[model samples]
Target: MEWTLPQWGQLMTLFMIAIAMGMDAFSLGIGVGMRGILLRQAILVSITIGFFHTVMPLAGMVIGRVLGLFVEKIAVMVGGGLLIFLGVNMLYHARKQGEAGVLRDLASFWGIFLFSVSVSLDSLSAGLTLGLFEADTLLTMLLFGWMGMLMAGAGLLLGRRVGAWIGGYGEAVGGMILIGLGLRFLL
Candidate 1:
């Protein structure tokens, strides 16, 4: 491909989208990391999240590609709505419990899996939107996975350092990020 200005713009947009999607993982990781996980556990959790970040979007893209044939025009809207809903749900939960319930155990396989899936749900919606627009799938997936991994790691480490100060507020911040991104997509 020629890597034109439009392509560059698309790539930048994709990168932003990846970060937006990863914020959930990052925020939730912070919440979970507050409980003091070992380095090994952190690595395992990050890897699991990275895997889900890639897989969920790939699945969404496939579904979106198939759905595009029928609802092409509204796909972006649907994707935006999904993000908003997820964001709102996160905020609600955070406010209700003031913490990520059941996320305290990062050492367990199912705990890691559930956390990974919860965080990656936004990527799936973003993938659907990108698929609707016929974006570069390989590039999108790569960026999503890369950003998700890096962000999750950073969040965990940061949480270990400052999680006590922020406490449960990290999830609220993360929820706001998602809502902002969703609004950006909508407008």
Candidate 2:
């Protein structure tokens, strides 16, 4: 297939969307990394989160593709709402950190899985939106997965350096970023 200007635009759009979707994972990874994870553990956690980022969106696209025929309009709205809900939930958790249950260690299997799911929820919604628009599935998923992995790694490393200075505020900042992104999507 010949690459056209419109196709380039679509690719760029998908790349931006992938980065946006990965922001959640990156932000949350920062929050968790603040607790001081080792290098090996960081690698493991990032990989797991990246894997979920890919899987969740792929699953969403499959479901959304089927549903798109019936409720394309509704799917976009639902996607927006889901992003808002996830953002608000993260903010709530950040605000109530003391009252909230202790976060699980990312080094553990269950901990990694739970964290991965929490971060990847937004990707699912994004995939749904992409499907509603009938975007290229393979390219979208690949970008999402790749960006998620890189962003998570970067966040973890950054957090390790600055986490102590930020203290508990890391999560709050992360939550704010997510909330802003969600509102942007809605508007």
Candidate 3:
């Protein structure tokens, strides 16, 4: 397959995009792990994030196809907005000295699933953006999933070890990074 400019751009952007997208998972993982989540919890969290990274983009593609071009643009805008919102929310939460409400609530599968969906919404929309491109959806989703897993892994691994050194505040910083990246897409 002859790679178009967009596809090439997508390839170049994939890693950075993944890193940006993964920030949320990383941050949340850090917070969750620091609070003593186990190895099973970490694996499940990463898997859930990975699952959403795959599924959400496909859904985004479907929405883009059915919802028309204007809606597709709207999807990107919405995704960007959500990224910023989540980032700000994380920073705000940082000021508070308690655990994340989501972490407290995520004692079960359903709860984690919900969290994964919520965080992966950006990736879902990102998938839509990728879908809009004349690029390979499978490759894009795979890249996205791997990146998400990697980011989540970093978070969990770090969280387990020295998260307390920073009082587990890396998540807020990660959230800020995500917000910046999301805003960049809009611009």
Candidate 4:
């Protein structure tokens, strides 16, 4: 078994990447927190997203390794598609909100999990990219997950404050972000 530390420069690269990757989640988290979800619910949402951040990329890596040169676009397309769908769905729900909210309390764990998974689909695609570099999966996941947690925690706080002011429009914007990211990957 080989246990490797991330190269000092790779660690920096991953850290910056982590922040970039967390942008969507941060935006979504703001909306979630603004909806008046309890602290416990926010933590659950964070954990779910973090877990997906770890797993999706690992899965992508495994698949990419097997499929070799043929998998990047597939992973990217899948990831981008899912993000757009999630974002669009969020916007739709927001449009239906009563000017004050979109998502309700986070009592539904499965719902949270699925949302987390959808947003992190791009992370899987990113993981495939990382795998091509022979990066350490465990280290990579740890870096990604921690970055998500920090960003999400901040977003939850900020979203709670901002969501109330913007109402469901925040969610609608988040939806747009998802769609934009997906399109970006395609081009």
Candidate 5:
């Protein structure tokens, strides 16, 4: 079957959004990578992050679906507002310095779990907003999980070889992407 222009656009949008959501994972992975993680540990951590990214957004989408039932007319506005809020929050945190002890103990199960959840929180928010739209659920989730895993894995490996400066900038770029998307929704 052939695809239409709008379908292609939607696919691209979802793909970009998935990458944006993974930026946090990538940034944090860089931090962890800088600390010297084993390949095994990195793989495990990446899988965990991918799981959270998938689940969180799905949960958000469910909630969003419920909300859409009550406020169909204003759902778009609410979604846009949420996206903007999440983006600004990301930007704010990205500007902060001091990574001392922020990424310690990632070797522990609890530590890894907490870190994964924290990074995937934005995916939840993005999912909530997406719930308002006619987004393809399976495709979105797959993109998010896959990108989150790949990005995190890359970050961890790169962290060992690169400087810590990339983490903050990565988050900032992700924030900008989110903000731009939010504005697009509003307009």
Candidate 6:
């Protein structure tokens, strides 16, 4: 089968967006890692973040599809708006770093789950925007899940070894990516 330029471009865009989405988990994982975590706990947290990244985006896509059905004409604008909002929110949160105190109980299932959900929340919004555009669901989910886990694991491992210098920058980069994507949609 032959591939077109637009298809390749879309694929690249999705891939970058997926990585950007995972940056949240990466940054937070770094904080947790700096605090010192067991290898088992890190694995558990990474896996949980991956699961939530997959599921949350899928759920958002479902909701976005429903919304698109009702407001097809304005769906793109709405998606753009949502992305911008999410991006701004991420940036806002990134400024308030050094909150690792809140994540002291990451050894438990609930702790892992809550942390995963918190990190993956932006994926949900991004998925909603992609859904309005009718993106490839399978690819999006896979990229999100894989990248979320991989980035998070990297962050946790790095955090354990390094200082707390790269704390919130990952999230800041992710926020910028989202904002750029949102502007792309708008224009």
Q: Where does candidate 4 clash, by residue pair?
A: 30-159
Q: Quote the lDDT for 126 in model 4.
A: 63
| Estimated TM-score for each candidate | 0.84, 0.76, 0.70, 0.64, 0.95, 0.95
Better of 1 and 6 by TM-score: 6
Writing each residue's lDDT as its tens digit, candidate 5 over 4-105 gives 999899899999899888888888888889989999999999999999999999998998989999999999899888888888887887887343335557
Write candidate 3's Cα lDDT for 1-187 as tens digits: 6988876876776666566667767766676667676787778878888888878877876665565455654766665665577567657765563543545345698878887887687777666555554346777678778878777777777778864555336556656676786688689
Off by over 4 Å in 3: 1-6, 68-100, 105-107, 133-135, 164-187
With a 3 Å backbone cut-off (N, CA, C), the pairs that clash in candidate 5 are none
Tens-place lDDT per residue, model 2, 1-187, is 8999978987986776677666656666666676788999888888887888788788888887898889867765665566566557656765675565445577678988888787787788778766766778889889999889888887787778774444335445545555565566578
Provide the lowest-lDDT 10-residue window in model 6. 96-105
In model 2, where do residues sit more than 4 Å from their true spots? 72-102, 164-187
Per-residue lDDT of model 1, residues 43-114, tens digit only: 888888888889888888888889888997887787677667767876776676553364666667887888
Model 5, clash count?
0
Candidate 4 lDDT tens digits, 69-149 = 555457556555655665576677667655543344468866886778865776786676556555667877887787777
Clashes of each: 0, 0, 0, 1, 0, 0
Off by over 4 Å in 5: 99-101
Model 6 alpha-carbon drift over 4 Å, by segment = 99-102
**Regions of candidate 1 where Cα sits further than 4 Å from its true position:** 97-102, 167-181
TM-score-superior candidate, 1 or 4? 1
Candidate lDDT (C-alpha), each: 0.77, 0.72, 0.68, 0.66, 0.87, 0.87
What is the Å distance of residue 79 in model 3 from its true position?
Answer: 8.4
Model 5 worst lDDT run, 10 consecutive residues: 96-105
